[model samples]
Target chain A: MTIFTNFFYSFMASLFFALLFNAPKRSLPVTAAIAGIGYVVFILITQNLGSKPLGFFLATLIMGLLCEIAARVLKMTTTTFVTIAVIPLVPGLGIYRTMQFIVQNNYEAAVQIGIPTLLAAGTIALAIAISTFAVKLFLHFWQQ
Target chain B: MLNEQEINKIIKIVKLEAQIILENGGETYRVEDTVMRICRSFGLIDVEPVVIPTGMFITISHDNLATHTIIKRVRRRTVNLSKIDAANLISRQLTTGRISLDEAIIQLEQIIGDKSKPKILTATASALSAGFFTLLFNGSLFDFFIAALCGAVIQLFSFLLQGEDMSNFIISLTGGIFTAVIAITATQIFNMGNMDLIISGAIMPLLPGLAMTNAIRDTIQGDLVSGVARGTEAIIVAIAIAVGVGVVLKTLILMGGGLN
Candidate 1:
């Protein structure tokens, strides 16, 4: 599929999730747009560079930074945007597949899929944390 | 110049605000920070809050004396980002002196009483998200419809089971089973949609994405206890979902039904 198609799918996915999570109604468009862009970036990086972790890290970092900015500008907690934005890249499929392999008694396939999945999850988390911390540091320096 | 009753009121206000945030998917560290800020705004120094996923313990002292501690056991948690945002805004306004204690209480009560999202909205949101997710995962149009149906079924089932006092594990496990069953039945009967895509897409709504993200956020902010607690919660929910899906898949296999 084209990048635009991917972006559309990602946008719709995030939009409805924002609704499900009961995010502030007004912020739905902004949150979904950011999540869509982030997921597309992940797909592009992963496809071109052949590094899933790098893709996850970069995508989340960008998403996290944008979300923190949006939160501050919108006067909401960072969690509101960050949580919704990360939903698209949360590796749910990997977790599901790993469990599928495990239940099939396919340990080798399970481990093969599981390790990367866990690593990707970790990378996404670390990137988000870094982005959050970076924003805090920037605010601190501005205050000083 | 604060009297005993006023101090008591401040303590109550802080506790209520923290409870709202925690119960509505605010991170533990955010809860702690907001609690401390509110207490400080009320001229209560020496505040310490220990917040885990399930409960909170907070102590606030005035002038290094006259300590008040409150323990709140949070038994139910759902993902409502709006509530967290509202609580955060209220606390910010309180700290900035833009809203008085009584005003804050009124606002917090409004949040507590606010039940705006109906069941149909949630079910629809689940359907759309699952359907779009299937498309993202390269599922065909047929699979999208099947996944959407499964999503709605899972959401309705979960809503039906909401007041049963079941654990998160059981709820998610049941949700997963429902998703797999619906996806499998729909795909197998029609033999049009991709079962794998439908199952994965439908299960997306049930995954513990928020828990895992919050766990990492909590840990990075030095809330090790909450971090560990939420991390374990995430793992448990994930495993429960896996088991739920696995059980259905295993049953289908035993019955010699082709999952393909």
Candidate 2:
């Protein structure tokens, strides 16, 4: 649907997950907002650029950087907010579909869907790691 | 810089912090870095912390001599990010001049355990998250409601099992079975068309997203042991979920349940 609608659902999903994990209650709104932005970025990039992997990569990078800033601002670890913020972009449907294909004895379809889905997950992780390292280094040199 | 007694206290504090971080699902390297930083900030000259998914070992030394090594067996590790956040904050303050050693110790102790909100609160949170995730996947409102209620019940079941010795695999296997059972029943009753959306949405709460993500991050940081361990853990959890769902579905098909 609309970008706003997509972002709204993303925000809600993140907000509740933040709650489930006992994230600092006060930081829930911030995490939800960031997740919305992250999801929106993913949708825009994937929809416009026609590249799911690139969308996840760029979205994760932006989300990771934002989480670092939010952590420093909130004086909490990045994991607190990042976990919820990153959840929306997780390929949950992909994983589920792959399992469905496998159980249906459709190994070919399982591999077809599973490879790209796993690749997307990998790209997201790599992007997050790269951004996390970058932010750590930035804070490192900036502090000194 | 700390004297002998203070060094002992520092060791106690940092070890506790490291154990909690690992249990709270911090990245393996992050746990090592935090433990090392705490020891260094407390004037320990040499520090080595090794963290796996299931346990941690930390050695503190001074003057190239071993002072103490603490081994902590982490049980029931789960993702509770707020604990990690609090520990990280306390350690940062400990390193800085903001909180004294004693105060830091107290704070770390306070943050050591996993924080549990009221069961109703968490159940509602699970419901809402699962509902919104269903909507995000373009499921209808009816499917969202079904998934939300199922998600909440599943989460409550898991919460109940927290005190038990149930393995993650068993918990997720049950989760997958319950999810499929619920989705199948709900779709038949409600005349919903999208089984895929409902099942996927319900399963979102069970996916090993954090474990998988942490596995990759751990490997990226060169903590190969932790990385492989977490990766294996994630795979097993995923397989458990798949098996749980697939078995139930196949049995239903055999029984002529007529799942749409």
Candidate 3:
């Protein structure tokens, strides 16, 4: 129930952003649904794998793949759609934590949280990029 | 033989064709010259064209003449407006709601207009910036309703103050700083969640981080020129955002003032 609720909220938030960006009217509802499902799946996997560094990397990779597939199916711009949909998965909390540490003058803890936050964001982007390239390659071959 | 520019002209001409047909109340023959004029304007000088015949048949009756006359007027109006210049003029007049559709169509036929691209890209960028800020501060629900209303007002302000050539880096920086101040104030006044989270999350849309990542990826993939340009732009935007926010925050702290 908790997971379901979280997914619902995330979907609503993402969908709201998608519409605000003037995303295609037809795709907004589907994008929001998939994003919610993606969040739930991510939470489940992360919990099972524990908070290990490797687990984090793998989870982000899978999330990126899922987002790419959704993007292709929707036939829309990947950057705009994927970026907005993946908001729920972003470590926004981590960024906040880092800022808090900085305000308290805890330079060490701030660095610790900030570095991981940056890495997480990069990993998400990397996964999306790789998946996007793969999708393009597949389309080329299919066309030929 | 149609060049790229001519092909674009034809597309614009075809879009106008629909409006002409509709205004003629479904008469096909009277609007034929408009189509030919459009083709000529596009420099399709030596062309063999086929006309697909269409007509409206009516029984011989007293009421039919009035209908036929109305249809004739519509068809004549269609032919007159079919030229590219007439079409362009009519399109603009219609868009601005300055003239009736019938009059615009008549004006369209007499002119072969040149195509002019608009210089609104800079205005588009500024509007996007303001939209991003509104999204961050208001969230999805409220932002959607409010941003659109605010966007038009802000657009005029941006146009007058900065013009279309205003730098994206400067715009993003100012937006980010404004967003941070608002977020911090809201958090304090509402006793919201950690100020850090609210502030950071709110400004995520304005971050140059995503742009940097994309730029690096493109560079690594051998798109050197695009990568370098995007990377440089991202770095500049990021520096501007950080400096703008940092200065404001530092000022507040130095003055022994807090958001609360």
Candidate 4:
């Protein structure tokens, strides 16, 4: 029940973003599906490992690869789906809360919160970098 | 058709396509690479292209002792993946000799001329995404509906104000203020839903995901100029959203709004 609800809402979020990004209409369903998978991977990893950043990195990595594969199969640029599907894992809430802490003059608590926020953002970057490199490597080998 | 006039035209075509891609939030390296590849396909060597967050520069140095250069100052950037996709298709076709230069220009013009979805549809998209993101964060159904309302309003407001010369920082700041005002009011009056989840969901779509990814990708590829530009943009955007929400929450707390 929990997982189903998570999947449903994530799909909705992705659909909205896909529309806003002006993605081709035909790829909306695929974007939603990929978003669902991304959230699921994040949940499973975070639940098992209790590390939010690690979960984020792994989820983004999976989503990036899936987006590339989908784009290839669909003959579309990978950007459209990747941006939308990855939306569910971004640490927007964390950043907001960190700011709230600072505004309240709670410096120590802010740092505690801010570290994780930055880490989450960093992990997202790292994941994109890794997946991009992997894709290039895969193509280079495949072509040769 | 491989004359000086045609080469000059091809240079313009490649620059325009690259500019469109960059203007639509494409990665900087991808922009440079795409332009380079297209020029290479035309047998034009020494093609130089430089791209940043706000503008682009490209110069095609050919054997005819004539150089064609373009300077495009992009005033805005949005998350239009469709533009990038269309540009890619054209570049691929041109490189593979499946399309002629003039045909590719026509195709690009068609892509550029394509109209965005109707305002009503985009606003609905904002509403649905915001509401659903709240649900994903474990908000109640009541919260979901209210979030949808807040999201829709934000979207419509932003779209309506798209031509007012408003910067992103200001747009998100206003978005955050409005989102918090609605979320807090609903949570208090109706006595339902989590305020945090609702506000975050409404703000999620406004976050700079494209900028963040492009920054990372460019930094990894050693394109420090593009990387830093996009990174600064992402950071500034994040701070704007955070400050907007923080200011509202602080004000509310001071006004006797309690967490109980």
Candidate 5:
């Protein structure tokens, strides 16, 4: 139940974000659905595995792979799908909370929240890079 | 069978295509690849393109006769994936010999001249995105409304200021201030809504997630210069938003306004 609701909210949010970014009209729903599923997987991993970085990494890996496949099928630029679909996992809340803790003069709590935020962001980036490389390698081998 | 004048013409057209891609949030490597593909299709085999976050340089040599290079500076960048898609399509068609040079030029111009969606649609998008994000953050229905209002106002504020000569840092700073002020005030006056949830949800759209992703992608592709530049951009925008929201929140704290 909770997972479904999370998916619903994230799906709606990413759909509107795709609109805000002016993605091609035909690919809007597809990218938004990818984002929603990616975020839900992130939540599930975090809840069960108790590892936030792993969650971020896996979620972005899935999103990036989906976006690449979608780009091939739709014949659009891969960045179009990758950029919009990754927004929901951006750690906006972590950044905000870190700022809030700093403003409240709690450096200890600020650092606690800040380091994880940076780590999570780095993990997400690495996952995207890996996915792109994986796809390129697959194509290279398949073509030969 | 290509004359110097025709080579020059192809150079200009290819330059314009690359410029449009870079200026409209396309990746640096994508710009380079597109330039190479387009130039190759036009019979300019010896083509080299160097693209960074801020500019692009393309050099082409024709049969050992002469080398021509064009350096284009790209100052303003905003997210509009439709333009990137259109440009991508044009380059694909050109490479496949499905379109003439003249037709490609016409299509590229139409894409460059095309306007984004209406302001109202963008604003409504911001509203709904922020509103739904609030729910994702466990905010109540009331908080969703508050965050939606903050998101709309901030979107409009930035939209109005986008055409000005102001820097992006200033705009993001002002947006942060606006988000904090509005969320805090709405929560205080109405005596409802979670301030933390509203603030976080409202700032979601302003984060530099795309920049960070692009930075990593560029780095992995060995475009280290562009990767570092985009990484800096992402860090700066993140800091600006944090400082803006922090300053406002700190001021309220000093005034003894409990952030309940």
Candidate 6:
């Protein structure tokens, strides 16, 4: 599929997820748009880094930040929007990769990928946390 | 026409209106102002509004029956006052010194307890089920079938376990593990991917990633208590699936089991 098509799918998927959580109607469009942007960014980073772990790291961080901004702009709970946005970023391939390693009895490779996957998930979480803190701080200072 | 008792009743009605709005995820400031306006409309000019952060509460007072009638009229047409409408109406009586705070609390508890049970359960199940199906399909047809099944099962299980008083965490964990095992087995056995990616996609509704993402987002958003609680619950569910799969695979290896 074309990049545009892919982004559309990503956006719709995220929107559906957001709706599941009963996200405010106003927030859905913004969340979907940001999530699409996150997917595109991930694709570009992956292509450039050529499967390096750092590439995935950067992509997740970017996605997290984008999601946070979308949540703030929509004035909805971050839990609903961010969760939906991150759906596309899930390492489905990583799980498959880990399964292949385990099946092959390559314990070393499995462990390596497993730890990195865990870290990758953590990096995404950290990015969201940092961005939220920054936004809150900015709001506090701006109000004063 | 407005007696003290009626004035208090109107005030209570407004407070309940504010509480319902906030609980449905409105901002704190908005709810406070809404409550204050309702009081003002009821002619409680000297009403000192105390803004409490953690607990959602509103109080209104009216001087007489006419004021209560007016407040009732305003409340009936108000949007998004489902849960706290009754409480707010009662609180107005309290504020006019018609009823004691203890009475107001008892009434609030009874109204909230009775009204909230069905709505909360239904919403929670629907949300979780919808979330599950969306993940299962990765935006494909398989999501629809699997989501429906998972949603039904989760709803039924939740309903049954409501009597047992199990938490959402336990329900989600058990549901996740069951879904994961079924998905893995279906993928290996049926080769459903060849026909529109059905089997693997069906399992998508059970993914733990959605919960993890939500947990992280909540934590980042400063709802640390709920975030940590949800995060831990999600992690545990993930680990349960991993362990369950690991054990099954180990058993199969020992038994010389092969994919049929």
All candidates: DockQ: 0.79, 0.72, 0.11, 0.77, 0.85, 0.14
Predicted model with the maximum lDDT: 5
By summed lDDT, the worst window of 10 consecutive residues in model 2 chain A runs over: A75-84
Please write out the lDDT profile of model 6 over residues B26-89, one tens digit for every residue: 3344345556655665566544443322344333433433322212211111112223334444
lDDT measured at residue B87 in model 3 versus the true structure, 0 to 100: 45
**Global Cα lDDT for candidate 5:** 0.89
Which residue pairs come into collision in candidate 2? none
Q: Write the per-residue lDDT of candidate 1 for residues A29-136, one digit (tens) a residue.
A: 989999999999999999999988889999999999999989888888888888888888887788878877877778999999999988988888889899999999
TM-scores across all candidates? 0.96, 0.94, 0.55, 0.96, 0.98, 0.57
- In the range A22-134, model 5's lDDT, one tens digit per residue, is 88999998999999999999999999999988899999999999999999999998899998898889898999999988988899999999999999899989999999999
Local accuracy by lDDT, each model: 0.87, 0.83, 0.49, 0.84, 0.89, 0.52
Off by over 4 Å in 3: A52-60, A96-105, A137-144, B1-167, B187-193, B209-213, B257-260
List residue ranges in candidate 4 displaced over 4 A.
Answer: none
Q: For candidate 3, lDDT tens digit of each residue in A19-136? A: 4344445666766666677666666766887653444455545555666676566533344445556655666456555655565567999899888877776666566567666777
Error of 2 at A25 (Å): 1.7
- Per-prediction interface RMSD in Å: 1.1, 1.3, 11.5, 1.3, 1.0, 7.4
- CA displacement after TM-score superposition, residue B226 of candidate 4 (Å): 0.6
User: Every model's Cα RMSD, please?
Assistant: 1.5, 2.1, 15.8, 1.6, 1.2, 9.6
lDDT of 2 by residue, A1-144 (tens): 899999999999889988888888868999999999999999999999999888999999999999889988887877787777888888878887887777677899999999998898788778888998998788899999
Q: Over the stretch B58-84, how does candidate 5's per-residue lDDT look in tens digits? A: 899988568999999888888888899
Best-fitting candidate, scored by DockQ: 5
Candidate 4 per-residue lDDT over residues A1-144, each given as its tens digit: 478877887987898878877787878999899999899989989999998888999999999999888988998877777877888888878877787778778899899989988988888878977887899899999999
Candidate 6 true-interface contact recovery: 0.11
lDDT comparing candidate 4 with the true structure: 0.84
